[model samples]
Target chain A: MNGSIADPKAVRRTILRNLRSALLELGSATKAELSDRLGVSFPTVSKFLGQMEKAGELLPVQLDDSSGGRRANRYSYNPEVMLGLALFLERTETSYIVFNCAGEVKDQGHAASVLTADITDFDALIAALVNKHPQISAVSVGVPAAVNNGRLIYIPEYEQFHDLDLKAHCEQRFQLPTVIENDMNAAVYGYYMARHQRSELQPSLVYLYFGQNGPGSGIMLDGNIMRGSSFFSGEVSFVPLYDQYNFGEAMRASHPHPRFPDGDLSVDAVARLIAVFAAVLNPHGVILSRHEANEGLLAQLEAASQAYIPREHLPAFILSDWEQDYLYGLQGLSLDLMLSREAGGN
Target chain B: MNGSIADPKAVRRTILRNLRSALLELGSATKAELSDRLGVSFPTVSKFLGQMEKAGELLPVQLDDSSGGRRANRYSYNPEVMLGLALFLERTETSYIVFNCAGEVKDQGHAASVLTADITDFDALIAALVNKHPQISAVSVGVPAAVNNGRLIYIPEYEQFHDLDLKAHCEQRFQLPTVIENDMNAAVYGYYMARHQRSELQPSLVYLYFGQNGPGSGIMLDGNIMRGSSFFSGEVSFVPLYDQYNFGEAMRASHPHPRFPDGDLSVDAVARLIAVFAAVLNPHGVILSRHEANEGLLAQLEAASQAYIPREHLPAFILSDWEQDYLYGLQGLSLDLMLSREAGGN
Candidate 1:
């Protein structure tokens, strides 16, 4: 290790990195506590904190009383220093969200349902985001399609987005590196990160997100998104659920006699479908978002599913708090990118 | 670096490790090739090769012909230097396999009609394996149950093996480090590793192993097993296919006014059930196998499945050629362990 390579600039960067991580994990910490954690002398920690404060990276916050001593000033990372831009696109609408370093939604904007095939609206969406959030450092867009090597390879259901150079376009427009991922993958990551933060659960997770037409599944193995070969591994909608019997005929047959003509396969039908699918995948849990999920219908479907499977042993199912799901995913992607960059630097 | 601390013992281990990986990937190499690949001097490669040959770890193979000069003698790692013991346990039978360093099966043995719930039989299975292959170095067992952190946490349909201390029992009997994994996990790993070796197509794999009563699914995401929280993911069989519709009712509804009056659901009915299930999961491919997946039955099942799914764009469906999918999984586990160990050492 060359002494010159460990220059003041490099040392300062390392100190900042350590402080950022500590703040991210602990929310806030005192200079003394950070010094002990970083194994740096108290004076060194104080000096770095001073420099970071001057650089507008850290903000001083009032601290609680220390044991029998005067209260020391605590420091927290400035949320506005860097922002993450997240774009979530579906069949009906395009949503853009800005999240701060602490995974909090700083701002959000949405555009009316735009057909993905007519990507003319995509440019407008990006333009709106850049204009709204000038401090955005990186952007991650979620598409209802398959992405391979950072390229949108296929969106069979949403054919318009297929073969689109969303990554290059976004990067050039925003002047920031961009990543485009499968919406299901993003949702899964978002759900997993949220669950992990809230509970003492396992590191690995499988999430099933139900949409209008079909359900999408995302798997996290060993604490990382397991993007299978060609990045189409988690396309669970294509997973076969029923044998060759006509779905239409089965639905009709399930309808009661003519006197009690069965109502349309309401939200309940979809929930039953989800429950069945969940039974098959046996994931950690299934997450239903109100944005797309028919909660009342799923409850009825779940009851039907129990009757069909006759097995009490099944993974838990929950409805995602929609207001937070997409935003949470966006924040998680930002953190993932930051962590990867930091790890690479190390 | 202290010269004495990095003596022949350390040097020899490193050289052997590098040589093992090179051989695993490239099969064989000349001393000069090994020297260049290992980034060691030619003299060091020669010395290490000589020592390895003396220790029976390296074997001199046919020479590689040069353009005009003397041919170069190529050395290969001895596959017998390390052995992997693989156990595949089913409801009624247990298959034991010993694999060489290169993942080729050396020998196989079997025990019949042993119930996993019966402790004596389980112990006898382990005893039989130890008695048969005393030279086995490491053991990997595949149980038809869900495993969480090496513990059989849930077996779903398997009433007997739920929450059993399988790893502990195996370790106690064998007095060797052992890995106990769910049968589906092993199947997925086996399929992934086998395809990687045999084909250039990097398809996302979803392996469905049809047992006597039902089927078990193993999902591979990005060439890795999608183990969920509690290692209970991929239990696709339990996914509900019909709501309040029994197998007989589902069949009768699909084929109204059937020629036969018998209430028994035909194998075709089961095939239909499978097809419907497959439609929901939409895997890149579906592999049907069992402890007894013979060629004749496999062909019939494949044909029937094709007829069941109406979608022309369905994923490829095939039958596993290997009789012992669990053995292949064991081989994969051993290979993974070896690769991880080498990675850690480096």
Candidate 2:
């Protein structure tokens, strides 16, 4: 929508894209209902639906209620026609989920740390999974490093993946559409999506993590995830929350891996970090990994941050299942890719 | 595009909106060119252009080149058909710019501080301006506090305007579309637009100003200006960059109003703030008010910030005319409002 229109084919593609998106959201509707919903002509909707039906993309659900006229047949999208793969590469393990367009997870599994091994191990893992699920049409990957449009731009710990275009590789290898995102970005997006469905309110949210790999954050304002100028947003480790030390240095000095707030120093550091997000972003909430969060830590953070800013201005501190959130976010991305690929004349 | 399409009327409105936008950007275009550029049918473009021409919204510009075919007529948008009013209510004075659709400044003036004066003074100022320029179709106002959808949610200095839907009041009184934005938000947006046209690269930028009112910031990440939950973003005064003092407290303690970094204490505080944005956002640039920034001060900041974070990660710090940027941003918002209003079946 931001660029110049290319041609009529592109315009038709957009209509089909909107129709598919409407159907996905509506679940089932009559031809007239879809035409009205899409603001497109009845003939256009009828033609596209017929074409998709022939391609096994649509299912006849039921007959619409008759209102003193002939009943129209209701059509539903075939969720099973497209499958998505979502995976996250972590230092200890690689986890994945295979899901349908409707977000129903069909299978989930884990593999050895592909980051420590090599790119071949990453390839083999995806290859094996794709072989198992032939219907998988799209893939989304989550990584611990900063990602620039599917390329690993900053992976100091994993040299094997550094500078690799993981999305291009996966898409080329499997002939499937793929996307690559930072782990924290995906996690926050997943959390935002889960909560957004219930409230339907745009939220400003932050996801923070002190992981085995490093410290990072994910920022979402008004439901849009922020990837910085070079996709370097959420690299909170570099944050100079204190004059004496950066967030990462402070964390490393005060605590051990995974379990944070080993002492008051780390607590102070984490609290200061929370205050930074509160003051700068004023998000609705700040989410932390459930594994590292508890009632005690949250209360301590709240009390500590109050020293810097008013308590009322502080965002709500929450703990979420980071693993689930990350995978769900990846799944969401993959499903979108599936839809967009199909809508782009697949 | 994100919402359910309502009907054919709404769809027609969207096509018209796109056509208007395309024409404005292209300056002038032939029917064939517009159709190809908008991905709409030739008949649709031709019909709408004819209607707009009849409405005096378009002007016949020139004829297109011919290559073994008939030459076509090129049409241009009538910039004089619509005008916008952009005004910023500052503590010192209220500055205004009456601009046409093409961003040409037709008139500029200043009035007494509306924030310090009563609300009637504000009304009278707008009335005088609108009376002089009867062609004005939209209004955009910039204020010094947090804004939530045009309502002044946080204006502690001006209690009379607090919680007032300034946009609603302006539109109701003037019978024109209106928008209200925060001073810093408008400034950053204006600067972004000015730079975006030249480079066309989406930028992550920050605008910082220590003014007579208070310290605040504007954040634009990847071309989107971030308004946080409750619209409390850019309140950088509360950011706890130091254990001993917040940014506002440190600035007030070391420096007088209108000037900054008068001593080492304020310098350290400002550097720490820049470091915070860098480590967290990794923005491409951080902009400062030209009035406050000097070569000596910037050098001091650049060196001091390196004490907190790496030099390479620090965003490029530059001085900008905050006043011009603020007005330009408001003008842009007003123009968009005008177009959107005309496209909404007006």
Candidate 3:
């Protein structure tokens, strides 16, 4: 681009942006690969690579086999270049973690949450984390409710959180870009990214979080979170059972005794929900997250699915990791924000 | 581009392709708009417009108002440039229609189909249509089955259609590009395009077809069909009912009568599913197609949805057009193949 010489500063910025994107996409790239991929001269790439390396934005890794000629160096994005703070809010407690650009945990904290929960102590915790790691560039949060463009529209468990705009609060307090997502959406996104690393796992998946109160699902089609018009697409708790009794009916005091025992596991309602997923979305994998999906429950679910779906067409069922999935999702959101800031420059 | 002194043929091809694309995207464009959109010189755009008009691929239209001063000519895609042959195969009979690029009907045909009915007479019908309209560029077929990469993988109601590789057969016999889509899939796609044009309908939608033997659904998330792995998504007949009996169980002769009359409607099951859709996917609208979705049925569905979903959160319920929605879907598919060929060129 500089060869045309229209504007030196603009071309330099473009070159740097392209270089960063190339390295991040490929995980690591040789100087020749960077030049070929970016349509830039090798010398310009080398000059920028050297500059970025000195600025602590890029790192050089020597190849394992170079044929003993001039040593070939592969460049990688510096994992520690920036930190992302993630907060997951539950009814009783709020948990937080700091992760680097590569999603590796650097620090962690927690504070109790209640109906009276406010940003006072939360602000203190964020301030402490930022004081320890001044490089934090973004914050991501997950809440148990319906969120639409950063505002909490509904939180049955915590009425105080309703209509709250946590994104603005975090941005103002931490002086960083912020994002708030539905807890179910975050967990499923995390699960998909983790499972997708395996070549055999299909890219499309649905994560059903069978909870104590009801069920909620998160959908990933073609590796993108399927955020609906209101950004509240995955609120599955409201799904009715085959009868007038919806999943939420289980929580009602006057609800009749369950036809199937064992809670969310091995329940007829859960199996019917799974059947709906199998027939409707036909995701490659349907993960039952946040529940003790034991082998017995798996057998019953398999049997129920067989009765409805063709045996040959049943999606693979797996129990998801209960604890780390949300954190993984938060990290994924953090990385997205950090990288998108460069592409969008805001 | 031609000013760069590049090969004139490649430049001409590029110019024609860009002009056609701009007109299609904008519905209509003047020479100035073409120059601005394509980043081509006005003279170059005007020259290509003249050439394309001569070739009958472009048509010039006068604006509604000219005011009698240097009237500008608006160019539109020649709707009659090529024809798209669409065949909708059903249980008792097969119907065919030929549409132009603008999805206007040009010709139509039909043939009877039975258990032993093969494509022998259907092939003759197709050949006759092609013989009459040699400009036909492609063929699209809709079948009631689970399709995977142009192969019919399952059709429990019609076993003969199973594993049928209709795309290759049509491609070889007609010498035209061919596409085979699920019938329900096409209907919802057509429904979306129809409603999408009105500006009042929500873009994301789910179309439920409660047929006599089975029920199936089609989903449109973010304006794209949600074709799951194996192209088998939206086979809603396989969804498990809340009771021991699933939807497919109705096919089993030994199975007892349905617990609720009217088949999944005016029943808790219908309400439950509506609530599920209301909360889970949060689509803008839900259209009940090909069913006796009368006022009573609508009342039941609305009440069911309202029980779990907040009144404000429910999607609009529409009694979809049964007869022409599928044809509209076929037209949409035909137009897509026609436009995509110009864009993808393969």
Q: Which model, 1 or 3, shows the larger lDDT?
A: 3
lDDT of 1 by residue, B1-346 (tens): 2222123455555555666767776788898887776666778678767766776677657889895999999888777766778777777787777877788888887887444456677677667666776656667877777776667786655666768787787777767567888777787678767657422455556776555555557776556566654454555545444333444354344444233345433355445445544554445666666544556765565676666454443456667743456567778786554433322231
Which candidate wins on DockQ? Answer: 2
User: Which candidate model has the greater DockQ, 1 or 2?
Assistant: 2
lDDT over C-alpha atoms for residue B133 of model 3 = 92
Tell me the DockQ of each model, to 2 decimals.
0.22, 0.40, 0.38
When sorted by lDDT, best at the front, the candidate numbers are 2, 3, 1
Q: How many angstroms is residue B133 displaced in model 3 relative to the true structure, after the best TM-score fit?
A: 1.0
Residue B65: error of model 2 in Å? 7.8
Per model, kept true contacts as a fraction are: 0.29, 0.57, 0.59
Residue B216, model 2, lDDT: 86
Residue lDDT tens for model 2, B51-114: 8888888876688888679988989998888889988898889989998888899999898999
DockQ of the two-chain complex in candidate 1: 0.22
Q: What TM-score fits each model?
A: 0.72, 0.86, 0.82
Q: Write the per-residue lDDT of candidate 1 for residues A1-346, one digit (tens) a residue.
A: 2222123455555665666767767778888887777666678778767766777777667786778888888888776677788888777787778887777778887787555447677777777777777767778887777776567787776666678787887777657767877776676677777767422455544565555555566665556665643354444444333432243333433444332255444333444455544544455555666665566755665675575444344445667764466557767777655523321131
Residue pairs with backbone atoms closer than 3 Å in model 3 (clashes): A239-B276, A242-B269, A243-B268, A244-B268
**Mind giving the per-residue lDDT tens digits that candidate 3 earns over B1-346?**
1122223455556666556656766788888887876677789788778866777687657773475787788878887788899988888788899988777898886678632476677688788888999888888888887677677777776666678887888888878888888887788888888656422434778888767656778888877788887666777556554555554453333343355554533345555565666666777888886355777778777886686778777778888785588888887777666654543233
